[model samples]
Target: MADGGVDEDEKPVGELFGRLIDESKAYAKAELGLAKVTAEAKAQAAKKPALLGIAAFLFLQAAVVVLCITLALALATLIGPLAGGLIATIVALGIAAGLGLMAKKALESGQ
Candidate 1:
């Protein structure tokens, strides 16, 4: 009883530490599982919107192609076919370059 004795009603230090460790491990595992489930649910919710966005992007690309073709055909009536195509291509390239530069600047500005 003189050598730092434990009381009869109290648990030993080693047993208490082991129980604490076990509970901590269980709590960590449960939290990780919950996080995984929550991430899966969020991804599932985003799927439809993501698909719709891709569809819209494709449609917009098709529209841009049609518009370019129409412009070339209309210009062909005034000029020759090859010249009209060349002019339309040059214009499209210039516009694309300007847009690219704008995007680059926006990215550099972090906006």
Candidate 2:
């Protein structure tokens, strides 16, 4: 201590600012680490739903294939096998085209 009991290492301005800058740097680093951990946790939480979405997409594709086969077989009981397959393909293509047109119209209207 100095004669007035002030700490000898204390400077009026320079020491205070230096400590402030150091603390600011440390706080910034800690905040960045916290943000990284938070992002990782959020990503982990979303992983299961992401995987389930992919599984659902795969299952839907399999179901569509099975349904198409069943449709063709049912038609074949009435029409011949060749005509049934052709009719099924044409119907599927027409339905897909109709769906595409509807989607385009909906998007345009939304905009």
Query: What is candidate 2's lDDT per residue for 1-111, written digit by digit as tens?
Result: 878787867656887898899999999999999999999999999999999999999999899878878888889999978888888888888989999999999999995
Q: Where is model 1 more than 4 Å wrong at Cα?
A: 1-9
Q: Least lDDT summed over 10 consecutive residues: which range in candidate 1?
A: 1-10
- Whole-model lDDT, candidate 1? 0.92
lDDT of each: 0.92, 0.90
Please, what's the RMSD in Å of model 1? 4.3
Give lDDT: candidate 2, residue 64: 82
Pairs that collide, model 1: none
TM-score of each: 0.87, 0.71
Give candidate 2's error at residue 48 in angstroms: 1.8
